[model samples]
Target: MRLFFGLDPLAGDKRAIDSWRQRVATADGRPVPPANFHLTLAFLGEVDERHLEALCDTVDDLALPGTGELRLDRVGYWPRPGILWIGPAAPQPALESLAGDLGRAGQAVGARRERRRFVPHLTLYRGCRVPPPAPAEPPDLPFRFRGVTLFESRRGRDGIRYEPVAAWEGGGFSQR
Candidate 1:
C-alpha cells in the first residue's frame, strides 16, 4: 500500500487554507481537496503488507515532545514541483523534532530515508500548468496539532485520496 505519516489540521484551518488557494491558484492548477489537506511528516512510498505491523509498532514507540500552537502563515510556490503550499514563517522546533522521530521510525522499518530536509508545509495546489505568483504576505492561521495519523494513499474516482488507517493523539503528551 502507498502510505505516509501526517497530521490533519482542524476544520477551520482547512477552510482558511482553501480560501487562500482560491485567491492565488491558477485556473490550470488543481486545488487539493479540503478533506485531503494535511501536513505530511514522512512519505513512506509503497510498502509490503508484511512490514505494516512493524511500521506501526515503531511509530507507537516514538518519544514526541510537546509543541505549542503552530502557525501556517507563509505562502510559497515551488516552481520545480509546481506546488503551492502554506507554512510557518519561522522554524518550528517541536514540529521538526516530531518529523525527525517519525522519519527515523520509518527508516527502522526499511523505509527509505528522505534525502531532502523536511520542510513543514501543507500543499494547497499541485500540478499547476503555470506556477502562481507568491503572495505578498501570509494569512494569519494558528492551530494546535491534535494528532499524527498513518494514511493510506489510493486512487479514487476524483483523484488520489489519503485515508487515515491509524492515529496517535498528541496534547502536550505522548499517546499510543
Candidate 2:
C-alpha cells in the first residue's frame, strides 16, 4: 500500500484550515479535502504487508517527545509541485525534531529518506496551472498535534483518500 507518516490536526484546527482554503483557493486548482489535511513527517511510499507491520512496530517502540502546538501562519506555494500549503512563520523545534526522528525510523525499516529538507506544512491544493501568490499576512490557525498517524493512500471513485492504518499517540500505538 502507499504509506506515509503524518500528524493529524485537532478537529477545530481542521475546520479553520478548511475555511481558510475555501477563501484562498482559486477555481483552477483542485483543493485538498479537509479530511485529508495533515502535516506529513515522512513519505514511506509503497511497502509490502510484512514491511508495513515492521514499520508500525518501529513507531510503537519510539519514545516520542511531548506533544506541542504548531502555529501555521504563512500560506505559500511550491511552484514545481504546484501545491499550495500553510505553515509556520518560523522554525518549530519540537515539530522538526519529531519529523527527524520519524525519518530516521523509516530509514531503519527500509523506507527511503526524503531528499528535501523537512518543511512542515499542510497541503491545501494541488495540480495548479499557476501557483497562488503568498498571502500578505498569516492565517490565524494553531494546530495541536495530538498524535502521529500511519496513513494508507487509496484511490477511489471520488478521488484520493488517506485512511489511517495505525496511530501512535504520545504514549503508544493503537489500531484505527
Candidate 3:
C-alpha cells in the first residue's frame, strides 16, 4: 500500500480553508479536493502489507507534539512540481519537531528516509503548467495541529484519495 504520515485539519479548519481557496484564481491547474487537504509529514511511498502494523506501532511510540497553531498566511508556488500551496506565515518549531519525529519513526519501520527538508504546506492545486495567481490579501487561516494520522493513498478511475488508517491524538501543551 502507498502510505504516508500526515495531519488532517479539523472540520472547521477545512471549511475555513475551502472558503479561503475559493477566492484564489486556480484556472491553470486542477484544484485538490478539500477532503484530500493534508500536511504530509512523511511520504512512505509503497510498503509491504506486513509492515503496516510495525509502522503504526513505531509511529505511536514516538513523542508526538501537542496542539500547535499556525496561520496559513503565505501563498507559494513550486515550478518544478507545478503546484501552488499555502503555508505558515512564520516559523513553527513545534510542527517541525513533530514532523522530524515522524520521519525517524518511519525509518525505524523500514520506510526510506526523505532527502528533502520538510516544508509544512498543503497543496492547493496540481498538474499546472503555470502557477496560479495569489490572492491580493493573504488569508488569515489559523490552523491547529491536533493529531498525527497515517494515511493510505489510493488511486482509481475517479482520482487519488487519502484514507486514514490510524491516528495518534495529542494531549500535551498548546503551542502558538
Candidate 4:
C-alpha cells in the first residue's frame, strides 16, 4: 500500500487552515482537502503487504518524543514542484527529532528513506504552474498534533483520501 507516517492537525487548526486557503489561495491550483492535511514525518512509499506487520511493529518499537505545539507562521511556494505550503518560521526540534526517528524506523523495515533534509510543512495546494502570490496577511496557525498516524493514500471516485490505518497516541499504540 502507499503509506506514510504523519502528524494529524487538530480539528480547529485544520478548519483555520482551510479557511485561510480559501481566502488567500488563487484558483490556479487544486486546493488540498482539509481532511487530507498532514505534516509528513516519513514518506514510506509502497511496502509489500507481507511486510505490513513488521513495518507496524518497527514503528511501534520507536521511542517517540513528547508532543508539543508547532507554530506555522510562514507561507512558501516551490516553483519546481508547483506547490504551495505553510510551515513553521523556524526549526522545531521536537518535530525534527520525531521525524528523524520515524524515518529510521521505516528504513529499518525496508522502506526507502528520503535523501534530503526534512522540512516540516503541510501542503496547501498542488499543480501550480506559476508561483502563487504571498498572502496579504500572513498565516499564523498554531498546531499541536495529538499523535502520529500511519496513513494509507487511496484514490477513488472522489479524488485522493488519506486514511489512518493506525496511530500512536501518548506513546501508546492504537488501532484506527
Best by TM-score: 4
| Runs off by more than 4 Å, candidate 3 | 171-176
Worst 10 residues of 1 by lDDT: 167-176
Compute the lDDT for candidate 4. Answer: 0.84
Ranking by lDDT, best first? Answer: 4, 2, 3, 1
Q: Could you tell me the lDDT of residue 12 within candidate 2? A: 86
Q: Which TM-score value belongs to model 1?
A: 0.87
TM-score of each: 0.87, 0.90, 0.90, 0.93
Give the clashing pairs for model 2. Answer: none
lDDT of 3 by residue, 78-129 (tens): 8887888888878878778878887777777677888988888989888779
Which candidate, 1 or 2, has the higher lDDT? 2
Candidate with maximal lDDT: 4
lDDT of each: 0.77, 0.81, 0.79, 0.84
lDDT of 3: 0.79
Error of 3 at 149 (Å): 0.4
- What is every candidate's alpha-carbon RMSD to the true fold? 2.6, 1.9, 3.7, 1.5
Report the lDDT tens digits of candidate 2 across residue range 89-167.
8987776787888887778777878888889899988877786765544587888876788898999999999999988
Candidate with more favorable, higher lDDT: 1 or 3: 3
lDDT-superior candidate, 2 or 4 = 4
**Tens digits of per-residue lDDT for model 1, 13-71:** 78877776676544457778998989988888877878888887777777643333578
User: How far out, in Å, is residue 167 in model 1?
Assistant: 0.4
